[model samples]
Target: MRAVRRPELRLPELRPYDGAELEPEGDYDGLEFAGTDCSGQSARGARFMDCALRRCALDETVLSRARIIGSVLSGVRGVGTDLSQAMLRDVEVSDARLGGVQLHGAALERVVVRGGKIDFLNLRKAKLRDVAFEGCVLVEADFGGAELERVTFDDCTLARVDFSAARMKDVDLRGAAAVDIARGIDRLAGAVISPAQLMDLAPAFAAQVGVRVE
Candidate 1:
């Protein structure tokens, strides 16, 4: 297994952010930023707690080293968003389009991503615990060198998803609608899947060991 490239996220003392300009190292708690256009905004090292960000256009937004907790993000379009080294906990994101999102070295706990399209999501070297991706389409999502514990994919499409060098424990894919292990199928030794999924992945599994089915 390869070593994970972890980021050193050191946030200073947070103050209040009023969503006026580019505020770094600010704290935004219990705010309702619904139906707002916060595109191209930079909120590095900000802490958001119990916030509601529904129908917000956050395209190309920078949220590096930020911490978001107990937030609900529905119908948010965050294409090309950068969330590197961020920490998200107890957050529910639904009906969002987060293509080309960067989440390298981030930590996610008790997060639920439902009914969304997250193509080209970069989660390299991230830590995910008790995360559920339900009814989502993750095309070409990269999880290389990520640490996953108790992560589940429920009725989701994982087409061309990469799991190379990922450390997975108690990861469940029984409810996945489509599974495409683009790389590192051998490294998923501790993953749990249903027998039906196993049957569906038999060809890939056979090809991995250089076995010929006659």
Candidate 2:
């Protein structure tokens, strides 16, 4: 299997942003949003390039259809953060604590997610390419109808993930710490897993094929 390409981010000197409130369709470039509370703010269709969001709050922040490129989000905490239909490229997200986030129809490329705990993430119909998730805990993440290419899960815990109607190519799950699929286990056509993982999922596989083990 080919290795997943990681994001190569080189952030320039950024100006500190002390903005009062997020504006819709705002254009922010080379800015650092440090310790900013952006909860319940609407930044829909905003564009953020070469930016760093460190220790920022994103609860219920609307980033739908937003474009985020060459950015880093570290230590961000939030619930119900919406990134639906957003485009993320060459981004690194680390140590983020999020729940019930919506990311349906989003496009992610060359992104690396590390050391984060997320729950109830909604990624239905999203497109992912060259993405690597490492050392993260994901619970109840939905990937229905999503397209995945060159995606890898290393040391990550996937619990109750749904992949119904999802398409995959070169997806590597061999390094996952744990894996649990609540639905669509038969849709793993182009995914790679370890023999131990296959054994662990044998019951599910048998159930799918209607083979009873007595």
Candidate 3:
């Protein structure tokens, strides 16, 4: 089994970001956005490097096509956060409470999401590499046509997740607390699941293969 590479972040001394409305295409570096309310802020095409956003509200915040590198987003809460087509590398998102977050066509590398509750996450056609979700609850996440590599879910709860047309490689789902697939039950070729999970998904498997268990 190929091991996932974790992010090695060495953040330098950071400056505090002023609580001002985020501007589009803003360039932020080595800054800390703590307790910032970024609701309805549009930072489209922005660049964030070595930054930390702690306890920030991101409701309807638009970060489309933004580049986020070596960042830590913790305790962030919001809904309808738009991160479409964004590029996130070496990022850690912990304890986030997000719903309806749009990450379609985004590219994530070496990202770790821990202890979060995300509902209606839209990752359609996203590219995920070396990403790990630990102890998180993902409800109704849509991964249709996404490409996942070296992705692991450790003690995570995935409910009503749609893997329709998704492609996986080295994806480890053995440590997931629950795996409830709402669609694409037959696309488990490149995933690793435990025997218990296989048993739990037996009905789906049988249905996929047209097996009748009377």
Question: Candidate 1 on 1-214: residue-level lDDT in tens?
Answer: 2222222223333333355755778778777776778789899999987777788888998999999987778899978889999999888889998889999999998888899899899999999987888899999999999999888888999999899999998888888999998987877877888898888888889989999988
Residue-by-residue lDDT tens digits, candidate 2, 1-214: 8899888899999999977799889999999999999999999999999999999999999999999999999999999999999999999999999999999999999999999899999999999999999999999999999999999999999999999999999999999999999998999999999999999999999999999989
lDDT of 2: 0.96
Model 1 C-alpha lDDT versus the unseen true structure: 0.84
- All predictions: root-mean-square deviation over Cα? 6.1, 0.6, 0.6
TM-score of each: 0.89, 0.99, 0.99
Winner on lDDT (2 vs 3): 2
Report lDDT (Cα) of residue 158, candidate 1. Answer: 97
Q: After superposition, how far is residue 145 of candidate 1 from its true place, in Å?
A: 0.4
Relative to the true structure, candidate 3 reaches a TM of 0.99
Give the per-residue Cα lDDT of candidate 3 at 174.
98
TM-score, cand. 1:
0.89
Superior by TM-score: candidate 1 or candidate 3? 3
